[model samples]
Target: MVYRGPYRVRVEEKPDPRIEHPNDAVVRVARAAICGSDLHLYHGMMPDTRVGHTFGHEFIGVVEEVGSSVQNLQVGDKVMVPFNIFCGSCFFCARGLFSNCHNVNPNATAVGAIYGYSHTTGGYDGGQAEMVRVPFADVGPSVIPDWLDDEDALLMTDALATAYFGAQLAEIREGDTVAVLGAGPIGLYAARSAWLMGAGRVVVIDQLPERLEKARTFAHAETINYNEVPDVVLEMKLQTDGLGFDAVIDAVGAEADGNLVQHLTSARFKLQGGSPIALNWAIDGARKGGVISVMGAYGPMFSAVKFGDALNKGLTLRMNQCPVKRQWPRLLEHIQNGYFKPSDIVTHRIPLEHIAEAYHLFSSKLDGCIKPVIIPDAS
Candidate 1:
């Protein structure tokens, strides 16, 4: 898949990736997922999202080749590649902060390298195609367990791991009330993971009816349609006896909708990196000294946020790009115990040829599409 411009992408022939470094490996993609973060690149939200870039960060594949120094993987190994590309020997990676590895991207202070995002993320071509070149092969890609489903393995690359990490950041104590903003895949997974973290109640907030219903059935959380309430934050506070939730998760990022001024300024005019509607709601909807976990994707630009309110409430704010590989062990156990099924949110499986159509459907929220998986060789 090649990006033509915003709202325009097409399947194009590209050269198969080759080993470019001693730590590199080439993988034949079996399944790749269009992440909600990918939508930011699709809408031209991320800086330097140049034309011809392939935008997919969640993928699973079979190792086709490996570099001379590669030790952990060999040909024919089924692997789930983490979205993060890190050298594993960096100062940050040494401490398990793989997302902040300084050895991968030149702009490592902002974020470590990522596959198929854009120049801002190290300019690595993503795995949305038939093949992808993976760097730091021994450090990043994990062999998929035999019992795991292919679709499930694909989501583990990003969504499932990120959501679980968000819950961990929230520091949810036993019986804590948690509120998740947005009913997207990340929010749904955050809600589900909150239960595993011992959250007594989980509430999901969104405007769409179908997504709200999904919060009920899929995440098994209480649902609040922001459209139905006069004030969403007040509604959230009311639900918690006017004390607000113990922990709040913001899963809606730059493209969030709620305030017209915020939408026009950030998402439309590009004056800010992203709209802070969901984030502001999180601040106002959390109790004093409550924790706020941000799992949403935002750009480097400034966003208008309620910093004073957050300070006044003494909210503990924790946010970061997920270190995907770090969360796999715990998530694997959850999957093995049947506590989570990453594929449950997969509502559409589209071939690479129809990716443009798939993007349209997802961007438009058509057909109740929750998540769309790409089949590069569906033909």
Candidate 2:
């Protein structure tokens, strides 16, 4: 799938990607996913989303070729390439902050490079196509364990890792009540992960019944339909005994539903940062001394968040573009122990040739789509 501007995507033939750097590896994509964050580019909410640029970050593939400097992987190895493109020797990377590496994106002083995002995020092409080039191959692309399923590996590439990171940021303690806003893949993962992190009670909030049902079945959490409730924040407050949840995870980034004005202004009209509805809800619904972990992908522009309330509430707000490689070993242990199924949320499978229709289905939330993975026809 190629971006031809907002709301316009098409399948086009492109040159097979090849290694360009000494530490790069070219992978033949096997499975790819349409992440919730990708919609920001689909709607032109993010800057520098260029025409003909592939828009996928969650992918797993077989390494077709490895650069001479690649030490850990070789050709024929099945690997999962992380979304963050960073040099291992960078200052941030030395400190385990790979997402904020200073050596990757020349356009920014903070954020590191990302695959398939616009120029604002470093212009590396994404892995939506049959072939993708992975940089810093030795440090970024890890061999997929033979026991791990391809779909799970694809989920780990972004959704699962980000969710786990969000939970880690929340610092959920035993007996803590956690509220996860958004029934999307990341939200589901966060809810599930919170349980593994010792959250005593978990609640998932969303408007979609299918998604809420998924939350119940997949995440095993209490569900709340935001549309049916008289007041979402009030309901959350009431559920937490009028105090608020101990921790809240905002998985719905810019395109969250609720306020039509905020949605239109940020998502549709591009007048402000993406909608802060979930983040604000998180802030308003967390207890006086709580944690708000933001795993949602927001645009660079400003959003109308409640900072003063957060300050008054003494909330520890933790957020970042999840460093995918950081959470692998733990996720592997959980999956091996059968704690969670990363692919439980996959509702649709589409061939890469039909990716535009797949994108439409996912973006429109049609046919109960939760997570859609693309199987490239190469293999």
User: How does model 2 fare in lDDT?
Assistant: 0.88
The alpha-carbon RMSD values of the candidates against the true structure, listed in the order shown, are: 2.4, 2.4
Query: In candidate 1, what residue range of length 10 has the lowest lDDT sum?
Result: 264-273
State the lDDT of candidate 1 residue by residue for 183-242, as single tens digits: 999999999999999999999998789998989998999999888889998999899999
Candidates in order, TM-scores: namely 0.96, 0.95
For all candidates in order, the CA lDDT equals 0.88, 0.88
How far does residue 130 in candidate 1 sit from its true spot (Å)? 0.7
Off by over 4 Å in 2: 256-273, 300-303
Task: Give the alpha carbon lDDT tens digit for every residue of 242-279 in model 2.
Answer: 99999999888786322434545654431123667678
Angstrom error at residue 373, model 1: 0.5
Best by lDDT: 1
